[model samples]
Target: MPATEFQQSSSSSSSSSSPSFGFSILSRRRDQVHSHSMESPPAGLENELEAFQRQVADRFHDLSAADSGELLSIPWLRKLLDAFLCCHEEFRAILFNNQPYLNKPPLERQISDFFERSVKALDVCNAIRDGIEQMRQWQKPLEIVLCALDNQRSIGEGQIRRAKKALIDLTIGMLDEKESSTALAHRNRSFGRNNLHKEHKSLGHFRSLSWSVSRNWSAARQLQAISNNLVAPRSNEILSTNGLNLAVFTMSYVLLFVMWALVAAIPCQDRGLQTHFAISKQFLWAGPILSLHERILEESKKRARRNACGLLKEIYEIEQCARHLNELVDNTQLPLPEEKERELRITVEEAGNVCKSLKDGLDPLERQVREVFRRIVRNRTQGLDSTGGGD
Candidate 1:
């Protein structure tokens, strides 16, 4: 054994007899567990768990605060080292003697076993870190999906509002023919003979408006058959001649009357189209405009339902993944085995030392290689010069 190993073993033997050699906050906690109830009280479980976590964190902090080498060279650590050395020495002795291979100490086998196990554990741990990184990356996808769903829901709501407004505008425009005709009459009178072309154009517009109202009036008679379906079967009374249907019918006649008045007020004479204009105005403006509103509402609702379902499903998936990740965080425990933790720290330091030693060794080897190369080049140059002089 090396002098340092011998000294470590001697010192460890002296310290191992002390009661506090491997005692820690965790050990005290274990004692508390046994001293108290067999089972922890349900009410205090959270507090106890929190305290234990804090203790572990504080202990690890203390370990990190100490001198790196001194932390590794503690009494308990030296004891472990001496134990390994003793087993190794015994195993070597058995091999040197003519002992059967089966007679090897269990400690030697355990050390060999731990070497492979430790490497496997490190590989698995690295893979776990990679898996964790992959899981973390998925969190962003979930967030993006949730955000997209919210955007779609907002857009759907806006579209419903837009469709509703369009229905309202269509209804109100159909109802405003009287006001439009009065405005047209005032404008035409104000612009009189100088704007005869404008008056003619206004007359054409009235003719077109009358034709449209006439078409709508005919369509309204056909809609009477489906009015109950358009409004609601239970509210069949609402589509009566005395109800909303009568109001819309009156608005249609009013629009036709305005059209006729605008046609009469115009100074421009029609070219034998008065009969056609009268026939057109007879059917103008009287239909169940509610059907248009209902159709628009139905279409909007369909689109909204589709978007809402898709958004809800994606939101559910996001919530599921978030909850799963949270549960994993809540359940996972990373224990701090002081002996193994110390050993790993020392092992890492030793590996670093070995790497430094290799670099130091390479420096000398590089110098020696450079010196040899220089000597060879100098000799070759001297030989060449000698040959040239001789020549």
Candidate 2:
């Protein structure tokens, strides 16, 4: 499908009446089920399912609308996470409202598979949270560089030397992180630490299981595990389950894409985007998701970006600014020339801007990642409970 068609479809769905129309349809159908009927008509139920798919497509359409400057940026990533959360909630509602079909033949097997995939994703979230902490460590050296060169009374040899040291530290840190797959294992951090001690005995296994996947765990392999056996529902399966199987398939793909995007944007161990899955364009949401996937892959293939620790725009900017400043400092003599000093200050100001962007953005981004982790845990717990403890 062409991109423009996706945009047109999304635009039509975003009209003011669309939301109310969807709500009224669902509300009336739900009322019928609650009052006079034990099961909604298949046609009415299908309308609800179609609305759910459109909403997923609309959310991703908005995400893919980001310009080049915004793509893979911190703010853009947060929006991506927000979109996933929204879709997840809506998918959960669909399952809740159609509890009868959940434990039935095809959907029962499909949902169990989804929950297993979601469990694998929890490890990704933990690794991603650790990756966020890794980014924070990089910030320390970056801040040192900013402090040394920013708003100085005069650009002098001592300040230049100090900033150079910080730049070298930042350089080494990024390089070590990129090259060493096991480096993060030594730190031993997880999202479950604070809550692990407080949970009841029955929940202990789940809490630990969610938080403490092995240190040798590979994000690349974890992603592959999630993608394993994931395929679109066949027509017969969809017809048999009142389309709930299709909903499970959609949520599974969304979960996989969101995790893949997180690994791409953050500095995680064994970061790889090569996990293979294809979505036919028959699904409305496939266009934007596949567009985004291709765009991010193209970004990773760029000469300057290919070897970087992460593909975050801010990370790229910081590395560029730091490289320029490092080169300037290396060739300058004590009693720096006017031209060199002026060039140095300009580079420092540019680095400062990147730093400012990180300073303002990282906290909120981490919080969003944390929220994603917690929500996945809650959703998995609820799902397993609903299924009478999934296999």
Candidate 3:
């Protein structure tokens, strides 16, 4: 079926349901699931499937509701990961309940493709974790700035000099990271380090050599790999699979968009947002997901953020605060003027706040990324087992 035909079908369904914002369609789907006679596929199964879609829509709707200040913040990113994990768990449950379908023809193919895309996403999780570590490195210099000027009775030339040196380091680090085309793969980090032995034993052929990613790996190309050949299921395929194909398609998009968002918000190698979304707005989740995509793109295009290594709000805050303080320190004399000290102290305080935010957020963010990685691995391993070892 042509995409326009799918869109029209979805639009008519949504319109008839009178979806208000987030969930009227869910209610309608539930009603339809219940209304089905005993001759149809298990109403309970169809209800679970529709509920999964509704849950995904609700989670993303909440994420999209974030204000501009909260959108790309560490807390917001955590929420995004949380939402993905929740949706993934529910999706896994649905597949487990309908295990027979997974080994069947159309669904087997669809499920196989989803797992492949998910395997590609594991690399992105590793890359994003590296990006998180990069931000942690930035935090060290930020801490030096805070230590130099924070909570002191009076500022001194020695402290100013120390802070100036740290600021320079911070500047150089940020600039080098932003301008470098090389991947962080040189760091040689992967979530598998602690359990490589276990994963190798269990994952079998599903284990990706790119688990640690190569030095030449490009996030842009990896994203393309995930999205390659992803398309909406035709009407016949949907009917044949009893709508499980739609679930697979939904999860594929969710995987792609989440990885894309992480690359956009975090520092990663060859970060690019040019991946085509191509989702029809007929999906309840598509509206919020695409809205966020456009908003992040707008943020990247802003003059100040254009060349930033990461679009993270805290990263921007650190850059701006450090730059302003560095300028002030360079222009000031040995016996600092009262105004200069006041200005320096204010900038230092601002930088300190940014540091504190990172301190509170980075560890949790890394933990969440780690969880996402482990979840993907477990899902793929189990999914393959359920499907009698996927191709």
Candidate 4:
């Protein structure tokens, strides 16, 4: 009953009654089903769902382009939202309501449901991301599945999230358990936006205190405010603040501790070890992360078969970033330390030799991964062919 939701609902009702809403972009094709093979589709005498796959991709791509975060806000997006939400409303209702009760983020729960119900996703998406990140660790991607999250990043650091009640209300929906995660996400995004507005006020106050024009012109005055964040140190928040580069993040955090001159009193938490492993395994270059896509397919065959096309798109991205990084590294020459004048000759030679070895090793490893991916492509393609849809 929010003002926005009410308007959208009324508009949607009016829109659906229009001739354009009833039309399809592509004409429907008739598939001749064999009488002997008539066990019927899983739910009914419907056509093989393979055709819908392309439609799903189109909508997903559009959704990515729209990037509004609401699953039901877009017309085509709602079709997908409803396919899952309305598919088994009676039995599946709890899948949503109880999910919020179970302490899962509502949007995440809804997305998870999509993975579980619709076409039974393979781990392919995660795998693709992991594989690319791995290859990227070595270098970066063919580089795929990038719907471009940079836009979301542009909203800035103190990003606010609104829509708690709107989201809660949207979860209530048309049928008894009608509202969807998508609708809620849409409803709340506006609220989140307002929160961002408030954070700017605090930031403005801080900036005024820190950067007030003063005759002191002292280093203390220059760094008075920044000094606290540096003095106490919160390691987990490495990537906070705008325009923080990779080198700065690495040196400040433990992973790049050896590169810096700091001696720390505290050790990084052991539990964070798992997070590091996940990052290395799923996001790092050359190691576990690079092999993520391959592992997911091998471990979870169900989603692999279902998500083959999207899987390839992801694999392609990983390969792309990897190659670009390799090329960049290979072409670049090393710079010797300027202060260590006497040792310059020896250090330069050693650096060159080491760089050559890495570049050479990566070239062949890249080829090997290419072959592995080819085999994966063949295997997945064969599986889909066996699943057998549109002639």
lDDT of 1 at 234: 16
Tens-digit per-residue lDDT, 1-391, candidate 3: 3111223233423332544243333333445655443224555765676667767777887888899999899999999999999999999888888777788878898899999999899889999887777777778877988888889887788887788667655654565334421222122122123323333332222122233557678899999999999998876566566677788998889999999999988987788888988787766677788889889999999998888888889988987897688778775786788888888888888888898999999999999999999999999998999999845
Clashes of 2: 0
Off by over 4 Å in 4: 1-342, 389-391
Residue-level lDDT of model 1, residues 303-344, one tens digit each, is 422221111122223223333322322222334245543443
How do the predictions measure up, each by TM-score?
Answer: 0.17, 0.82, 0.83, 0.19
The TM-score between candidate 2 and the true structure equals 0.82
TM-score of 1: 0.17
2 or 4, greater by lDDT? 2
RMSD of each: 44.4, 10.1, 9.8, 28.7
Off by over 4 Å in 1: 1-107, 149-391
Residues 1-391 of candidate 4 have per-residue lDDT tens digits of: 1000111122212222332111111111113333442222233111111122222223323333332122112132223333322222321222222222222233233222222222211122122223222322322111111111112323211211121221122122110113333443353343344443443233232122222223232222222221122211122111121101111121112111110100010011110111111212110121312232233334224442232222222222322332232232221233313443223323323333333433444344334333433433443343233323212
lDDT (Cα) of model 1: 0.27
Tens digits of lDDT, candidate 2, 1-391: 2111122333435443543222223334345535532444455676667778778888997998899999999999999999998989988888778776677787788899999998898888888877776667677888998888888878677887688667655655565334432332222122123322232232222123232446567889999999999988775455556667777888899999999999998877788899875988766788789999999999999998988778999989977887787778764687877887788888888888888888899899888888888888888777777777645
**C-alpha lDDT of all candidate models, in order:** 0.27, 0.74, 0.76, 0.24
- The candidate 2 region of ten consecutive residues with least summed lDDT is 183-192
